[model samples]
Target: PICLLDTIGKVFEKVIATRLSAAIEAAGGLSPEQYGFRKGKSTLDAISKVVKTAEEACAGSRWRGGSKSYCLVVTLDIRNAFNSADWSRTLEALQRFNIPGYLQRIAPNTSMVGFADDVAIVVVAKHLAAAEELANAAVRAVESWLTVAGLDLAAQKTEAVLISSRKAVETASVQVGGTTIRSQRAIKYLGVLIDTRLSFKEHLEYVQRKASGTAGALSRMLLNTRGPKQATRKLLTSVVTSQILYAAPAWAKAAQVKTYMRGVEATYRLCALRIACSFRTVSDEAALVIAGQVPLRELIRERAEIHTAVPGRHPRGHGGRGAAGRQRPEPQEGTGAGRDSQPSDEAGTSADPKRGHGSVQQMPTRGYVPIEVEEATAPFAVQAGQAAG
Candidate 1:
């Protein structure tokens, strides 16, 4: 499918979108659970939330010494989401959120982390039946909302998955618009294959296959005797490697398993060997070093740390410096740098020794919070503050 947008119209759309996004953010019209098309949120954040919640639920069950816990994830498919959207409903939604009338005339545009039309509802419970019940209620709620919003839910394409650590889990299902959606062992959400145990084994295997194919294709064109130079080949290898590392932060833990690491390293080694123009017999570690490429494991860890350290994306709070602040090694006496030396802030200003770089004054307060907003009432809790002012 091809989408053609006039250059001028596209620029105008971006301007309008930016303005509308800022207004919505100020009023807190968006839910914290939402991660799509918003600043400081990504697929990694959504995946992390789901994985952590499922892990905690299963762990809680074991601690209680009773029935096992299960996490029910329902992914709903919407039919032609953008085309079917009701402009009137969107305008009304904006109005209800106390959005400026000028902005309401422009444009309108999940979670229960949605990216465009993809929406996943997650429910965790001690029993499978209870989990199913919760999932059914959530689905019904979504269906009703969609109906009112002039959208159609593609019940046939909807998928449900029951996440648990046990091998023999009783399959559970959810009812969606009179259609029964059975739970699967694994479901692909936002390009990542999430399985029952959240082990990400299937996802990693798929990545290895894809990475190997990409590297193999590039290798043929990048022969040692002819074709692209070593530097050019390495650049191409990095580009392909980045694709393989998509959502790496979410599945980094799974890479720790020896079996999983073996395949992943093999794929990485192939790319490294090609870049270094080395023999196949070279060790994976030596090949990566020779190519001046970071090991896959270390690369994944570094990416995960960066994701956590990013200001708005930090899981704990706004000011967390993540691994950078916590894990930075102290300077030795022989080194010119002092132990008390402070890192420069993003603005290039030297931070005070007493206060870390990410002090309260430096971190701006975020507009969105985790407070629940009932659809029946006016959305955007921040609207109250705006009204009072």
Candidate 2:
């Protein structure tokens, strides 16, 4: 579960209550900001409200000036939250804002897909909406591009969701298509504790254990009485969810996981574990960024070729030119050398007219065109050829 620090004192009160209460309720319940869907107020306005609330709460409190200045402890639990969402349409809407420089400089490539639908993007934005828009635009662009390329986009669902964080607010939520999901709450919750000393390994192990336990419980509930295949399928499903949800921020930064059109905080243990585990094997920031922004399938399909490039095997040679270079021909007949040997026919032209125009005739490799020459010119032609030779 994640916790958003609405106000420093309010969050502190919840933390203190952790020792006494078995059931933990959010300090001010869940905030809409947790899911990146807060509206009717600017970010600054929201911050001001939170700050004022904290000050009031701290006024006569024992922990310093709990009212004058309070710490909003937003905790993010990265264990099993759906941070990497499939909100293709939202991304498209955000991309319409077009902060290309930010995307290229920060965000790299993003590819998302579901069944017959797929979207791939190569940009990033400084804020969640921008990032979301880019993904949305890519989804539409990909859908259209694929359609033109003889593929389908609308035959299946394409979607995405993202999480973002700042010192003042918490956010999370789900989205289907391009619109913000307003009806659903997060299946799981998260709470993040900043400035902690716990090692990544320890935290990761804990999350893994927790995920395993959850999966086991679901498996038992659905499989023992439900059957072996159902049980096994649920196990795999849980594992995949765990894998995406549990990553080290070091490998890929956690998205602002949102649900019900708002943001929330995750446990510090979860955030630390994700960050720690993320940096383990992956090394590139671009790869990590894409991992955070897009889904697993589309990324794999779109980048498999580029990601698998080998030494001495040029990318253009393997396929064709990219956005700029001259395209290399594929291994098909009548395309390369054979093209130069054939003279394209013009519509409505007679054979004689074509021949009269001195157009090169496409002769069959097995046959030849025969010509008869005048005897008077033969001697002069022969003399000229002989002199040149």
Best TM-score goes to which candidate?
A: 1
List the candidates' TM-scores in order.
0.75, 0.20
Clashes of 2: 83
Model 2 accuracy (lDDT, Cα): 0.26
Q: What is the lDDT of residue 269 in candidate 2?
A: 23
Per-residue lDDT, model 2, residue 289, is 51
TM-score of 2: 0.20
RMSD of each: 10.2, 32.1
Model 1: per-residue Cα lDDT over 68-187, one tens digit each: 467777777777765665556556656766777776644432100112666776666666776676566556656665666567688877887788877686689889889888999788
Q: Look at candidate 2 and tell me the lDDT of residue 214.
A: 51
Q: Report the C-alpha lDDT of model 2 over 280-311, residue by residue, as the tens digit.
A: 34444443353332333222222232222211
User: All candidates' lDDT scores?
Assistant: 0.62, 0.26
